[model samples]
Target: METTMLPAIVQVLPGDDFTVYAYCNDGAVRLLDAKPLLELGGIFESLKDPAFFRERLTVMNDTVAWDIKGNRDETCCIDLDPCVIFRTAPIVDDPLENVI
Candidate 1:
């Protein structure tokens, strides 16, 4: 999948990080800032499915879905407080030293 065809908002199910790469059907790579790719599918596994706005979503627009396999964290709703890793970096005085 080409980058231009990719969707703007992606919601990862569970066990997803920014480093994870989402490969579209047409061979486009998109780096998710948060959990854009749903974690329903297993990690380190190849997922095969049509792109949808949400899981169990019937309407198919330009969103890219997955059917991968591997390790994954199962959570229904994402928590904003506890899941600090997903949130933006905290304010820090040091620029280079504070890198995650």
Candidate 2:
């Protein structure tokens, strides 16, 4: 529910430069750090765990935004919450669909 101020700095893991992102809406974030999978031979279970992602991920916002400082596209959704992956079905549309 925070706004204006950028969130805290998250650390980057080994391998690809992907990082996490945090925003004010829906306490959004994304775990862009593609390290664990790379380290585990490209198979990291946490990526697909519903509860785990729900516990550590967030929706960020209905619109797509990126974390400038994150190096990667990771971002924040909640304190450490997961996201509702399928809730986006009804909202998916062309980029210009909602434009003025």
The C-alpha RMSD of each candidate to the native structure, in angstroms, is 14.1, 14.1
lDDT for position 65 in model 1 = 29
- Among all candidates shown, the one with the greatest TM-score: 1
lDDT of 2 at 59: 29
CA lDDT of each prediction against the hidden true structure: 0.29, 0.32
Evaluated at residue 87, the lDDT of candidate 1 is 30
Q: TM-score for all predictions? A: 0.21, 0.20
lDDT of 2 by residue, 1-100 (tens): 8655333323211112433332223333333443344356322444344334333433223332223333334553222222322132122223333779
TM-score of 1: 0.21
Shift of residue 47 alpha carbon in model 1, Å:
19
Q: Which residue ranges in model 1 land beyond 4 Å of their true spot?
A: 1-17, 35-100
Clashes of each: 19, 22
Residue 91, model 1, lDDT: 26
